[model samples]
Target: MDTQFFLSMDPPTVTYQEKRAGVRNGKPFFYEDGDLKAARQKLKAHLSKHRPKKPYRGGVRLVVKWCFPRGKHRDGEYRITKPDTDNLQKLLKDCMTAVGFWTDDALVASEIVEKFWAERPGIFVRIEEL
Candidate 1:
């Protein structure tokens, strides 16, 4: 696997699923939740700062590992929580697209996402051109 680029962001206060939305004027809209918005903004800023010189235009593979702060569970333990892995991917991919990590999130032909308990919580992402 030839990795095009990699990025790591400190754990965000709000997880992807925590982003709330509502209908206004008959149109769905994300709520102006300060914490959620701030978390997404922080992710975008980090991605923009570390984005590849040129966004990947071809088929790409994305690997995302989310490390959550350890609670009663031990480190490396898989988290069985409210936010599903797919839900988490939604926000992350959106942020990557916003920061121009790739021409489009659709360019990602393969994806692997996982969550685990850890002492140092963070998000680790790797992109490989396929």
Candidate 2:
């Protein structure tokens, strides 16, 4: 099965209090509220069960996604832009380095995309150039 590994780059900063003041202050995905590690595991389990229908080029293609109505805010089609031949090659190199797959010169700015995937903050999706 085609699969891609997506380890959150930054720390888990997703936080929101579901209860009112004095009720119970809380953090998002925290161990007390929920196990984020388990969430990742659950997500992986779900994916493994569904069996992706496309090929995984080490995260270099379209990842068809599904969203429930309540998650309208998270709806998006994301992908990193494909740079020119040399740039594309360099991007792949940097991406590997960023993900700890390689140890070459690393730079996040090297990845370029032709389309507007998303520009909002707190977003954790990137469409890789296929």
Tell me the TM-score of model 2: 0.25
- Stretches of candidate 1 off by over 4 Å are 1-10, 13-32
Residue-wise C-alpha lDDT for candidate 2, range 11-120, written one tens digit per residue: 12212221123333564432324543433344334334333344233534323222112223433443333322343233233333344332343322334333223323
Which candidate tops TM-score?
1
The CA lDDT of each predicted structure is 0.78, 0.32
Rate residue 118 of model 2 by lDDT: 31
lDDT of 2: 0.32
Error of 1 at 38 (Å): 1.1
* Residue 41 accuracy (lDDT) in model 1: 88
Worst 10 residues of 1 by lDDT: 1-10
